[model samples]
Target: MVTAARLGPEERARAWQDLGARELDVLVVGGGVTGAGVALDAATRGLRVAMVEQRDLASGTSSRSSKLFHGGLRYLEQMNFVLVREALKERELMLTRLAPHLVKPVKFLYPLKHRIWERPYVTAGLTLYDRMGGARSVPGHRQLTRTMARRIVPALKKDALTGALLYYDAQADDARHTMMVARTAASYGAAVLTSAKVEELLRAGERVVGARVTDVETGESHEVSARVVINCTGVWTDDVQEMAGGRGRFRVRASKGVHIVVPRDRINAEAGMILRTEKSVLFVIPWGTHWIIGTTDTDWDLDKAHPAASREDIDYILDHVNEVLSTPLTHDDIEGVYAGLRPLLAGESEASSQLSREHAVARPQPGLISIAGGKYTTYRVMAADAVDAAKEDLGPGVVDSVTENVPLVGAEGYQALANQVERLAREHGVPAWRVQHLLDRYGSLLTEVLHVAEGDSSLLQPVPGAEEYLRAELVYAVSHEGALHLDDLLARRTRISIESPDRGIVAARDTAELVAPVLGWDADRISDEVAAYEARVAAERESQSEGDDLTANAERLAAPDIRARAVGRALD
Candidate 1:
């Protein structure tokens, strides 16, 4: 078994020192899936690599995705077969080979509104989708009459549709998946550090040499030297290009997508559902004991760090999904809400939905390669292309990408552990469901995680107010995962922010104190972290109550960023 690299405080400090001490082959900026993918690809190819992120891993757009790894069905209609086929191949890889423990098959029911023509049209699209997937890990489409559909989803309105079609896709915790990717890269001897922001570009004569990075936690700066710097900052691609003082080849436009989480019992559906909106498609995803109904796609020009969901966005989702629901939901039904930005390649179309999801890689300068505009499912392909673009600066004898054959950390013995869930649950004195949950999250690393709570059984108990997670997980988040602040623990590490009805406010203090010893937080530090988290939740709540984007953004900006506070600076 390839043991995962520890990303705790000590490892982070060592990584920072190593980053500044040597001249690396490739320096990756960004800790999202694509950046992590590039680090993994470059490292496994026998190149010295280091990656740095300004915030927690997957803290931005990567964490807030629809959490699906499917070949885009809409792309088939748009005749973007190359993207669809590539994404499908990647999805198959994740399901069967690379990350089988994290990615799982999920079924979605497409309700047909047009009686005579819809079925055949959808059938044609789904047929090509099934064929493009190559090695099939999920079942193909199945047609069902209105009555049959109602039997599967009793929550549907009587007149919602005449028939329905079911197709298979895959889902995962995007944040956890991205974090695992970063850890896997670290395990492959790549230096990975979070809370390290790129302050300036280091230039040697005409060619870019490296970056001046600032440690956000301690306000200390270090210069990291490398032959080539790969920019994979997604929505912040333009910002990085500007920082490099290069002539950017392309522009990235931000598109905001919002999702609301509701209790599962509110919608009595065994299978997830997909509905066609006027602008884009909406997904009613089954997320644990909740149903995640989303997404309104619109152009966003405001804050990139925090995208706030306006009242109109939430109502738009509710109005569209409620069109077919037997029991129409009110605002009170929403347990949590989140918004994220998509970095689309700027095109002629005025609408964000019309922009291409296809990625682009360009060597705008001698030693700087910038990659932008890609879906999460195709991140590996994007990463490989970025590294390939940097080959000129990387010099000779560089090897090809080997990540397709390399399984992520914890994927090796996941199935073996999965087969022994009952035994593990009994030994741990937890329920079978708890073992299953841990298996899905940590896979074979569940043992390593459980090892954190060895001396005290109380740590094994569920987190106060957030019963879905154990107290041990919070401790593990700080002691194992590189969670630096309370916000990281509540938002990215455990997803308590968007999963809890109170937006994790009730559990913030308890969780902060839970990891205080590991994080070396004093009483004032714990108080500050808890207060910041609470203010963030309050700002989000107020933002959701606003009528438009501008008002929502203003409300969201009221909360001070904890990371910014650590650096003794304010967000621009």
Candidate 2:
């Protein structure tokens, strides 16, 4: 059996040592889906690979997406068949083969305001969407009358829709999926390290060779050499290009997208809804116990690391979503809000919504490759194309990408384990629902998580403040998953940060205490972590209240990064 690639503190130290001791075939910078995907692709192709991220995996745009894997029905209307077909094929692959444990089918209802011509138009596009990639994993489009549509979605206003068309797409927890990709790469012998920032690019004369990486935790620096350096920094693509001492062949524009989460009861819907906005489409996705809405597309020039959602952005979404809801949502109904920046390829269009979702790869100079602008669904393709671009420096022995055949860490035996959910629950002395939840999130790897609870049934109990999670899961996050801080566990490893109404403030102290022993956090460090998490939540709340981007950005920046604070104390 292949050993599960556990990324605890010990493994991270080994990775940093490996990076400094040996020359690598590929060094992938940026730990988002694309960068993680690149590391997996290069590793599976029999190349020595290492990946570095300044923050946790999927901490940026990867975690804050609308979380859909679709053919972009709007693109079909634009007559972009190639992009739609490619995305749909990738979607099918994910649902059926690649990560069935993480990605699953989701249905969306498109409410039509017009009586006659609208239904046919949407139906045609959906029909094309259904057949584009030979989509067979999920059911095709279905037309519904106003009564039938209302039966499915009770929240819709009586006259809000003349009729409706329902279509199938897939959704996944983006951060979890990205972390699994990184873990899978590590399992395949790739040195994956987080909180390791690349301060500068290493060059041998005109050819880029490697990078100088800094360990954010200890403030230690190391020079790591690689034959090929692939840059997958999404919004910071141009900045990395500048670090290479040359003008990039293409420019990357930052587009801000914001999503608000509300309790599931706030919107009485059996199926998710898709509404047409003047600039772009809006999705009311059905998340577990909550409904995710909004995603305003606007230009963002301030902070790429932590994009702030203004009050205007919130109002824009609420007003549009209220157009069809019988019971309208108010500001008080909102549980959480998050903002992310999409690295869109620059074009002539003034509106960010008009920019292309297609990705571009450039060999800006020898041994340097940069990829940008693709959406979440097509990250694997983008990664493969990036490696293809780096083939010149990788030499002739490098094999073609086999990531399509590679399942992520927990995907294997998932179906069998899912079938025995009841038996598993009985063994663990927990509810079947809890077992099912663990199965969905960790798949066959649930055994490893449950192992942390051995000799103590208390670990099986639900976590305080966030009862949806098990206490064992928190310990496993530090002992197995690469979680170094409270924010890493709350935000990306699990999703308590964005899911909780208090924005994980209520869970901070308890969660910090839970992982303190494993992460070697003393009393002072635990207090500091809890304090920092509280300040972050407060800053986010303050930012959300601001009316404009400038004020919001200023407010959000008030919270200092934990790593920066550590560096500061070291300097003192």
| Each candidate's clash count | 0, 0
What is candidate 2's lDDT per residue for 1-572, written digit by digit as tens?
35669999999988988888999999999999999999999999989999999988998999999989888988887787998998998998888788899998999999999987988888888888888863589888898999999999999999999989888899999999999999999899999999999999999998999999999888888999999999999999999999999878899999999999999999999999999999889999999999999789999999889899999999999999999999999999998999999999998488898888999999999989999998999999999999999999988877888988888888899999989999999988999999988888888999999999999888999888889999999999988889889999999888898788888888889899989989888898899999998888989999999999999999999998876776664455
What count of clashes does model 1 give? 0
Pairing residues by index, what is the TM-score of model 1? Answer: 0.98
lDDT of each: 0.92, 0.91
TM-scores across all candidates? 0.98, 0.99
